[model samples]
Target chain A: MQGLTAHFGGITWAFVLDLFTDYGLFLVSALGLYVLMSAGQVSLGHAGMVGIASYSAAVLAVKFHVPFWLSLPLTGCIGMVAGMVYCYLLGWRLSGFYLAIGTFAFGEMMINIWLTSDYLGGAIGFSGIPLLARWPVLLIVLPPIFYALWRIEHSRIGLAFRAIRDNETVAGSMGINVARTKLMAWMIGGFITGLGGCLHAHRVTVITPTEFGIYTSVTMLLAILMGGLRTFWGTVLGAAVIYFGPWLTTTSEPRDRLMFYAALIVILMILRPQGLLASRAAR
Target chain B: MAEYLFEQFLIGISTGAIYAIVAIGYNLVFGVMNVLNLSHGAVMMVGSFGVLLLFYLGIDNFWLAVAFGIALALVTGLLVERIAVRPLKGNWWNIKVATLGAAMFLENFVTRLTDGRPMPYPRPFKPVYYTIVGDFEVSNVQLFLIACSLGLMVAMMLFLRHTTPGKAIRVVAQNPDLAQCVGVNVQQTMVLGFALSAALAGCAGILNAVTFGSTYPFVGQFLGLKGLVILIVAGIGNVRGCLIVALVLGVLESFSVVAGGSQYRDLVAYSALVLTLLVRPHGLFGEEGRTGREI
Candidate 1:
């Protein structure tokens, strides 16, 4: 909702401004959720957790004079631990709806803690982290990340994880270490989500608890749900739609935006219960 | 320090009682229907708003306001089940998302209708403190809240164990298909289950208003999450577990606030859920008695 300014401006600002941030956040967040969900862990709170990571990274870089390179990975590691803990607790036994609730609660807790903590700049968030995520950085990061996600989802490990999601007892009987696979998925999901947060922190140059809360998490889920939860490319497509759809459609009111999203989720779930790309097609 | 600790303990019990009521509703729905009611808290919020509306309309009597609120919550719950949940029955994930949709719709709709202003709910008892044990002072409202909550919980347990409809509900919960074959009317049972759950949540809303003295549209947001955590802590699909866990949460929250600050109160519930779930997935008390419908 916070639109960027283009003072070094002109016609390019309109094209560049909308293209970079709006579409950019949408794409990465969508891709991230898609990959995570395909790996058999649905992160309803990735938005909030990622926001925390990004804000943490940004604050260390700007206020504490920590180097960006040092700050980013450190933020990622923190998120990794958070994700592992979340999984180690709830993920071992819970799946589907229960897992979603736990993750969502964890996300809310993180946001609340961030909002109340003065050291993290409280609700106002931190700003002015160096903008190191540019086209070149995107070019390097996007391909490898996408490739890795693709490779993992196609691997035997991915099959085992999916089997767990489908039915854990059966998978366990088949010799899959459900806990280990789930934990690994959680760590990877958190690590990537943290990476996204770090980049987001640098790109926006400011972070706030408001940015991370339920809305962001819902939006990220929306991206995955709409594009297609199972297919890797579907997530990218879904992200693009969620990111750029409103701007292309209409910017009427905030309520309208919420309505649009709600409508999108309802439609997708009803129309494609197996997700946008049918499971048959994915197989 | 002792006095402060004692005072906070009283506050904690009362607050925890409200959570216990909500958690009980969640436990009932989960126990019977096997579907999580994401809109259970939303229905409770509607109840709080219903009471506020009644109060605004000159129905200032506390009990009268509560009755009005409960009736409204009952109708809302029935309608919610018919429109939002029934379509997604038999599919757990779909049901979860559907309820989430209902929750989103209700939350945003309320926010829009109110222009984001919190609806003020008058406390049943005004701020009046009485010293206890010659040292600590506990608010009368807090004591009343705790008493009423414990009473309601007992009443629920008695009803579930003794009443005809309650037995029917338990039977339906244990085996809906078999219950249906025995002419239990599965659809009607689901409706009743939701209605019963919603009514309890309404009571919780009233009690929460009594404790906090104000009701915001988004109050249920946190309460919903808390209920979910309590559900897990008690072990999903277990009513008795929910009650015990909720009390534990209340006591811990109270002590945490006393030991740290009010801001840290949530840390207690969140941490407890994280820790307990890590150690025991089915919860300390949960023994899965066939969650959801028969596959």
Candidate 2:
């Protein structure tokens, strides 16, 4: 009991445990973004993806009484299938700015729907969800997920993703199915990110569309970008930075905080456009 | 009833003209350099706010204030290009995010200064409604807005087509490497492009503040998005198309306010944007964007 309840640095043990849980959840989402970025795809809708899983998990929990553990993989499967289908159908036509804007629009539309829907409790969002995804659950789940992602990062398909990221034309000429590879990235990334979202919803016990918008999505992108763009460790490091940077700075005011983050991002881009973790590619 | 509808149509024209200028701003930089200049909208807001700040500082002449605002916007645009765009050196995503960060930085800086409050705009003259046709009313401000935008648009079209600098912009747009090889000062021309676009944005931003009655820090986010939406729907570089679409959407919005209340007004434009992206991502007149993807 004493070991479990030990405090550190003016922070209580429960807060530390929660912080760990939160960081893990963010890492999962960051890794999802990492997969897509590795394939040179830009999605400004990760918050919406997380929202989808959260709402789906909420409905599953409320309507079907699905257990927490079962719902985790269930939501991920749904996200994977949804991502694959969506990318295969309409995503192939979109490449650069269009893809980014389309995803942004997707996020906006989701927010609109949530705000207007009565079933989802509209703007306020529905609550009273069971907090089944405790820190222990996060601990049990995260290691395997990270290990799997590391394995995937080194796999054959991962190489295809990188090939496409560098240059699609060359990747296509090499007989890699560019569209299919992108779809694979989105699908797998969506799955892991979906789990991240599910864990978040279950932990918070309440989900609101307000918390998931373009700003949040942009912050997610910033977090990952801050860590590093291409490296696997960069994603993890980004999650950590985003999770803890503000807390360490002790910036309590929202306005100051935004300005700080904005300045950091702008300065970082100017100073190290390649991000902190330089890629293996010779500049 | 016909006269009332006509008055509504005129109202639509004024707003549409403003949108046209905003879209043109987007097009100028995009056409010449393939840079999105996402901060274009914030620069727009800065122009109006510049005028407002000067007014508060006791600059009595509105025209002079407007001139100063244009200059301010030009500086902001150049700063954005320098900080957000030039550093990345053609990395699209980094540039996009950086520009967005710059925009966020500017917006918050202003917001912090103002305590996130909306400031009342200062117009050159008080609006006076004239009975143009037996109870059909027209404000001098509206007429001025419509006339000013039309004149600016015509001037821009002529400038881009006739001037040496204009041709240089077109040449640079076609192929920057070739343009450089041909001894055209690419960097200077790019600066000229930003100046031109920023000037237009300044005009639109001030016009927006006048029409909307108040100016706020985040005003650009919504209005800037509308400009981007117009740009996308009109097909990135199509100035004429942008004008037509902006006017048509404005009229549609006017009529929508009549038919379905003001609530559904934004839906008309946003849905159109989404549809265009879904149906034709290249924009209606765009030649498959090379900035984002490969052929």
Instruction: Please give fnat for model 2.
Output: 0.48
Backbone clash pairs in model 2 (N, Cα, C under 3 Å; residues 3+ apart or in different chains), count: 0
The segments of candidate 1 whose C-alpha lies over 4 angstroms from its true place after superposition are A1-16, A63-98, A105-119, A122-124, A132-140, A154-157, A172-180, A240-253, A279-283, B57-62, B125-139, B288-295
TM-score of chain B of each: 0.93, 0.94
Instruction: Return the DockQ of model 1.
Output: 0.32
Q: Write the per-residue lDDT of candidate 1 for residues A27-139, one digit (tens) a residue.
A: 66556556557656776677866876787677678778887667767877876876787676666656665566567767777877887788888767766678776655566
Candidate 1, backbone clash total: 0
How do all models score by TM-score? Answer: 0.86, 0.89
For DockQ, the strongest prediction is: 2
Tens digits of per-residue lDDT for model 1, B143-212: 7888999999999999899997888889888899899888888777777778899999888887887677
TM-score of chain B of 1: 0.93
Model 2 chain B: ten consecutive residues of lowest lDDT: B286-295
